[model samples]
Target: MRRVLDLAWLALLVFMAATWQFMPDLVGAPQQAMPRDQHMAVMLAVAVFGVWLTTRGALLVARLAPGLVNLPCRDHWLAPERREQTLADLGDRLAVLGLGLVLLFAGLHYRALQAAQPSWPQVPDIAWTAGGVALGLIFALWLLALMRRFGRLAPVTTPRPVRRSSRSRDLVWREVQPVWPLLVVLLPIGVGVGLGLFFRKADDHEAWLLTALPLLLTAALGRMVTEVHGDRLTWRFGWLPWPRWQVDLDEIVTAEPARSRWIEGWGIHVTSDGRLYNASGTQAVRLTLRDGRRLRLGTGEPRELLQLLKSRIAGD
Candidate 1:
């Protein structure tokens, strides 16, 4: 039943994206536009072609450069059963929240449309568009929930060893050239500010939402802090500490110095091969976990950090 609902939701999204090219017309805006059906067909074709190309390219690259591709794993550092339970719990909550929000928004949109105009013709189009948006949001929330529940569930063959001694070594690396990560963090804020300026005349309620974008983005990506304490490797944004991820030394199969491209940028991102938690510098240490999942942590001194981790793992 859940899978069927998910597929239906995805189909609705494809339909909406296809017809997005005619959104102005659907919203009753005054403009000369292409025929709605014809425009939708073109857009649908383009979107499908783009997705196909991207998937094909990714697969080809994965085959050619296996090192670049990180095998998917159930657990990053947490025990497999525990991670699964955590995800299932979180997914249930998010699924309920998403469904409720969709219903609430759909009702509000319908009410607004009815109140604005006592009309027949535009109602269907407007309702359809609004419902599509609501469905898209619900789908996104549900998808995220599912990914969280399943994405990190790898079997924990190597259990994290309990440290008997409180004594632990710490290795910290500051970005020698911090400008890029700084710019990466600020770019979104700049764009948000630009949008706010362009829409200065927007309603007060909408303006408040627009104003919050930069602050939210800054909190999410502002400053990257990477630290290794004992057998645990963790990284978090300087502004927000609650959402940090960690890697247990026991799970690490190997740690080696590696280089990242500028295109990879800086942030917590899931790459083709594995998950990356990076802040600044091209220098990084890639840790291949026992489950085959890879984690690349950016640092100014990749070689030193890599050696430190390996030595610690050996000592353990």
Candidate 2:
């Protein structure tokens, strides 16, 4: 289902490119004496450029480090040393992902400047280029907040609650288990490339091709830096330095699986009163609060993990 949504997003970008290409009059009447053919050519060129940008983005996401993708999930994998390593690995991935998002917006801003057209209506250019950068930043911050909520930044030395039971104890959930949904970035690129090839309205395929490249590349790089571990109910997308979040059991309200057609593209949802942890599908355990409100439990669900949490919380 997630893949399907990605494909849909890709189609939207391709359609945008195609529409921009075939219909020049739609954008605006040619200001200069540039021939209609030249105007069409330029529009086509931009469409291609858009495709490239979209593709580049996807490629960046896919190329994240291998260790993030290959973290062990079995019980033995949870040895103290391994746990420490997981924490370290996750922190690095988050930092990297955060930095990557910042860079992405910066690059978008730069491109917007290069794309500025004084003679043409400034609104559309600003809307596309500058507005895009703004939106990207907003999205990045939103993602960062998610990391924070997951308790990614808490100091390791912070005093922790005492677990009286020796048989079972609360597992501190830190880094996001590396998951591969980052591949979704490719959806837009695929659509751009596919449309460019199939939609023969334009004489030049270069237009669509150009637009797909950059988006795919960027997506790949971003993917490479992170992975969501459905088993661990965590995501690892940082770089070499950064604290990984470790969501404590007390803060979690309810952890239940959820689905969404839009927001998450399809995964789990962890909500706390339909607010704070209100993230959409990504495979979450809904943490039910004392007020009956819910929060998110990251990606993984061990055998009877929810039962264990409930029993533990009840005792508390």
Candidate 3:
């Protein structure tokens, strides 16, 4: 349903672009003179896409569970001191966005007065442009500060060891050796970005480069699929692919996290339950054992994968 809605929105944007191109004189004012129809079409399409992307990005941020929403018998692992720090960091970043919008609106009337004669009255001058650019940089820096604070919170999730017995138990213990799916996907994109940046003219290059950034990131993520082996969890990126996590199979109790196509969003996400793993806009399955622990992994073949893991653990 979300996919269908997204496609419909894109189609509407395309239709609007076509209308703008064929009806530029109708859209732009008489004084400014019509931009070339082709150029206008491209610009309009880009603008629509940019706005859609920005809106979607904000939604993704909002979906986050916020402030250590999960505690799986591992509260001891959490950074006791960093909780307040994380909240403070979030408040500061949110303030930056708030202040930016306030300034943007407050200056709008002044900017409009200056551009009254000009057809595009909304456009600001070089000084205002510079100020806008500065605000953007400050916003990015504030976001980075928040990310660093979040990183500090992550180390607190270190796994704890558990006691095990030789008695048979219904368990599903499998490890991802190397994550190579992402590197394979990203290599082409990085190459494309590099070529466009170097071969194209400056004017065309920047536009193409700007457009390529998201594609490049998506490709990188596509390359980041995991490989399940025995006891180790591996994360790969190109030649640098290797194991980043090597948790003992016994250390992993039931690792079930809630994952439903109905609820999970795109890309790899660790849910508030600490049991669900969603890597894309795809299928989901739950894992359970005789013990209380549970694990959920979103895979293309969830049923088959679950069976395989059960069999593997049974053999172990």
The candidate that achieves the highest TM-score relative to the unseen native structure: 1
Per-model TM against the reference? 0.48, 0.33, 0.35
Candidate 3 yields a Cα-based lDDT of 0.44
Which candidate leads the pack in lDDT? Answer: 1
**In model 3, what is the error at residue 260, expressed in angstroms?**
1.9
The regions of model 1 sitting more than 4 angstroms off are 1-210, 261-263
Instruction: For candidate 1, report its TM-score.
Output: 0.48
Cα error, residue 224 of model 3, in Å, equals: 4.7
Clashing residue pairs in all predictions, respectively, total: 6, 103, 17
**Tens-digit lDDT track for model 1 on 111-146?**
434443453123455776777787777667555644
Q: All models: lDDT?
A: 0.55, 0.41, 0.44
Worst lDDT 10-window in candidate 2? 223-232
- Backbone clashes counted, model 1: 6
- lDDT tens readout by residue for model 3, 210-261: 5576554543444334444454322332232221222344444343323465
Q: In model 1, where is the ten-residue run with the lowest total lDDT?
A: 1-10
